[model samples]
Target: MSPPPEHRRAPPPTDAETLCRTGRKVIATEAGAVAALASRIDAGFVAACQTMLACRGRVVVTGMGKSGHIAGKIAATLASTGTPAFFVHPGEASHGDLGMITREDVVLALSHSGESVEILTILPLLKRLGVPLIAMTGQPASTLARQADAHLHTGVAEEACPLGLAPTSSTTAALAMGDALAVALLEARGFTEEDFAFSHPGGSLGRRLLVRVRDIMHTGAEIPWVPEHALVLDAVLEMTAKNLGMTAIVDAGQRVLGIFTDGDLRRLLEKAGDIHAVPVAAAMTRTCTRVTADRLAAETVRIMEGKRINALLVVDAAGRLIGALNMHDLLRAGVL
Candidate 1:
């Protein structure tokens, strides 16, 4: 008998509290899955890292569906962290992308079931090519696990999905395992910050590690300067002409005596002092924060931020003013 539409039973709409609890439960489940993978890492994990490290060519990562997304991210992490790698779609491999794989390269396949048809289809071809295969899968007894040169078991107790169908816990476990392998290989290869900078030249890390003060500082005639004995008016003019909002007060030898800034001008005006009447030295900051040309621009940013100033004087060993850099320069150079 069909139930009346008005009396038909449907699961009650999930309440707000249940929704919040559901989200937390999913997160907790995935977190525990990732945590478990840490202790489960064994000799297979070490062998996988060794295989990747010895790969003379790029690491070609391939998978399908959710595993494919995780594989792409893993490949990126491996490449950026010193193991050159890129992703290949397994479905496309049999069509043509398999040509991208080479004997010098290694194949890293990702599949939760270890029985993805597309992946298995190419396994025999990969074997015939004599290329090393590294598999990341949850099913250790599955066919994909048995044929690999190294198999990294990323098995999880259960999926975070309430239905236990969607890839949640397993995916998190696999991603964490991938991160573990990448970092272990990174340490084993002795990858350095400079090497990391090379891989990420357009990012903030590259700016912090690669840019030096001399690379961005204003030099020669572009520097704003005034003689120590000059009146505050002349210092202000130099500051305006150079557009740095400040001027270095120097002695006859060009050694920095102090610095005068627009902030000093504001305070002087508030005190009802005459700018023309004041000697630059009287209005200048006597103990100025300075940097050398060889310093990392990021350090220069720290100095400005720490001192609450917008400008820095670049001096040599003798403390003579050689260049000047302001916050705008740092911003323009991507140091800010």
Candidate 2:
């Protein structure tokens, strides 16, 4: 006998082609919506950016329903890209949350229809507080847009949803417009990758941009080094003790004169049986690459890769050895 209806296996879908076609159509529709925004970046877009850029407090983004979700994301993007911004729920604003908006703040409200009752209810309060308002909506003639200091039209030709109920292409347009505003403000403020890294210090991007060579390099006694006049055996012993596979040959003042690696020792061993008596300076690579302690660790990785070397010595402005690092150090520091 067959199992109960709820436990029974369902038949495989016979409209796989229809599913794929619908999915592709949705993507194409959304792409077109986003593309149309390129033309909408006119005087109004400039006005919105100018208002946000000049905001002394923050860009307060607010919306209801699906628009709220998009507004939240826009606020996050703005905050991360060097703009001071945060999201406020329109519905909650009527219930004492309106206190969050100060006179110095600029309110960015989103509603595709421009008639969200929750947002409209707070308009009088915003006006009383004399806070500047930027509105993003499909209806340019609606109350929100008419009262806004700057209006960004994110109108879409149609929804990708076949039933015409769900927000699909319109939300995509609004998101793209939000990103454009954020990137514009970022450029206007001269925000750099290093600045962005500070906002995201817990991520890999932060590690790559904020981790300096001085922060990761082994210093003092941990640095494998030998006197320039030392024998090859002494350099080898230092390399072994430090386990960095190389040793720096420095002068009396701790200035790097040359570098000796395991490869050089191997070559020397092949040519001469008595390496113990050979001077380290004679076997070292006279011209070697060195980096300053202030450099980004990511730059050191590129230097090592380009020159086909595994280790580097860090020096001060006067060319005195200060620290040392190898590929293993980079890996341990999460820079590799």
Candidate 3:
């Protein structure tokens, strides 16, 4: 007899469906983990936070395999959010990277099972170094947990993985718990946006948070200015020479009284008068918006946008002209 006719089966799903299903399951599992954590917060959680805040040195986070990756991210988040933290692979720490740690530091170890061999291998050395240990593990009674100075229960109900072998739900729980710790400490220390800016000095947030108007505003010779009594023609010359599109009209005390912009010049030109003979003050916007040089550039952007203007004169508390900034300055400063 001929071989049985081959039975054809339907092809597997497209990549998009698979990813969608996986993402939904992961999100559901993580939500459940966060829900579980709410009830579990107790004395131990407080102790863990206290241990981290009390440490004089950096927080050295460590883990093995997949947990190590999560540990690295946790360390980065902590470091960027005002906490000084760095990751050390458990395997590497056992070999020699343990020297990077000190008694003044705190060790945050991550393991889903709470029995990672590489992590356990260094427990004794960490103990010898007298470093406070904060354990993030699914099993509260596991060896790592028992040896820790503070054990944070990252126990998840189950993994999002169908086979329940991958470190899915557990890692999510651990990462959330790490964020909780970092944020708690961040709040406890009264850390501000300026502090965050220091850590992220090269990023967009740094520019927005740390850059003040004085840092980029045109001051001294760069400022386009003319006396209040100066004619419109002189104001135009000053504006053109400084290339700021506007000129500040100030009194003899250098206190800003008004501003004359290209728009104002246009309006003045439409009037039936001698532009050359008219004082610049007559064409200037007297109730002009102004900002202090010490104000944040980001705030200045908001003020400018809200006022529907392109330039502003930076002045002191007594209204003395100190500097000037335009939309182009904000654009160059990455605050626009």
The TM-score values for the models, in the order shown, are 0.92, 0.92, 0.91
> Candidate 1: lDDT over CA atoms?
0.92
| lDDT score, candidate 2 | 0.94
Residue-level lDDT tens digits of model 1 in 55-102: 999899999999999999999999999999999999999999999999
lDDT of 1 at 5: 95
Tens digits of per-residue lDDT for model 2 on 89-143? Answer: 9999999999999999999999999999999999999999999999999999999
RMSD of each predicted structure: 2.2, 3.5, 2.7
Off by over 4 Å in 3: 1-10, 15-22
Error of 3 at 321 (Å): 1.8
Supply every candidate's count of residue pairs whose N, Cα or C atoms clash at under 3 angstroms: 0, 0, 0
**Runs of candidate 2 exceeding 4 Å displacement:** 1-18
**Each model's lDDT:** 0.92, 0.94, 0.91
Candidate 3 C-alpha error for residue 332, in Å: 1.0
Better of 2 and 3 by lDDT: 2
